[model samples]
Target: MKKVPFIAVEGPIGVGKSSLAREIANYYQYRLLNEIVEENPFLGNFYKDIDGWSFQTEMFFLCNRYKQLEDIEKYHLNKNEPVVADYHIFKNQIFAERTLQSKQYEKYKQIYYILTANMPEPNLIIYLKAGLNTLLERISLRGRDIEKNIDPAYLLQLTKDYEQFMGKFINDHPNVPVLTFECDHIDFIKNKADLEAIFSKIDDQLFINN
Candidate 1:
């Protein structure tokens, strides 16, 4: 089969995945699919008390993302243009693993794996990397109310897990090209040059016109 006409940008919170996704979508004139965090009613409470609302939050996101992927799959089957999504569906498992107990994780994984059986995978995945301090600074700069209460230690752990997951992902799926960018030295949000560099990466990896 030809490469899937989909691009996924992924990273832990405070990295510029969403921004880069939006920029790529606009630049390429592709459909944009964003993670629907704002639509989830349980998200605020989940942020405030992860132990209390973790399951609810994760399930809500899993269902929402599955629906989005289903819709995107249908769209792709009918069209040729690419789609740029901020978060890949697999990242939901990352959150669930972090939040759920052993039994809960197993149960959720069974359901998630079944639902995503025919889902479309990205042709190119852009994984953003940032140090804990830089992530903290970006998180503070964003100024989301729920995010203000996020513990620094929790963010650090999430970062470590993200790194491990991406490392394993690369090892297991060598055919799927992944471009990793470290955000400590570059500010794509404010610098045109940085944005151009990111666009160049997308072009080189996905567009085939670089």
Candidate 2:
């Protein structure tokens, strides 16, 4: 039997990961797994004072994401159901490493590895990337009160971190395909052509190329 496709849409803040994930899930009629962002009690504080709240924020996200992925594996993936997630579990490490102190990061890394050791990996990763200016604009347009205090410097650095992590991910997970899109050039949300173009590429990777 052919394996069910599990696609993860990943990127830094304001990169439209959730939007694309939603579109993909709708198009394929697959299960949608969105990360619990607003529910993170530490998130608002983390955006204001990253150093002071980094550990708490990271831990909250890690635990919740682990539970989410666990449920998806049991109720969806194992049952031959396809799923499209807005964020990948590995992104937790990206933020933790960027904000946590060395000792805190070491501890967090240990927990992350243990929790994710047997988690299901995505068959395909749709990575969206854009300029720092574009990211800031999108974040402002969304007007999430919790994200109002986000630091541009931090967001810029997070983008760099994501790029580096994705580079390493490609090398480590050679069998898993990573489809990248430049969000600055393509407005998949508003333009039908752009949206269809992305869908075409996804179909090519998940079906034709698979």
Model 1, 145-184: lDDT tens digits are 7787788888889999999999999999887889999999
How many residue pairs in model 2 have overlapping backbones?
0
CA lDDT scores, all candidates in order: 0.86, 0.94
Q: Which residue runs of candidate 1 sit more than 4 Å off their true CA positions?
A: 1-4, 207-210
lDDT for model 2, please: 0.94
CA lDDT of 60 in candidate 1? 92
Error of 2 at 6 (Å): 0.3
Model 1, position 202, has a per-residue lDDT of 76
For all predictions, the C-alpha RMSD in Å is: 1.8, 0.9
Specify the highest-lDDT model's number.
2
Off by over 4 Å in 2: 208-210
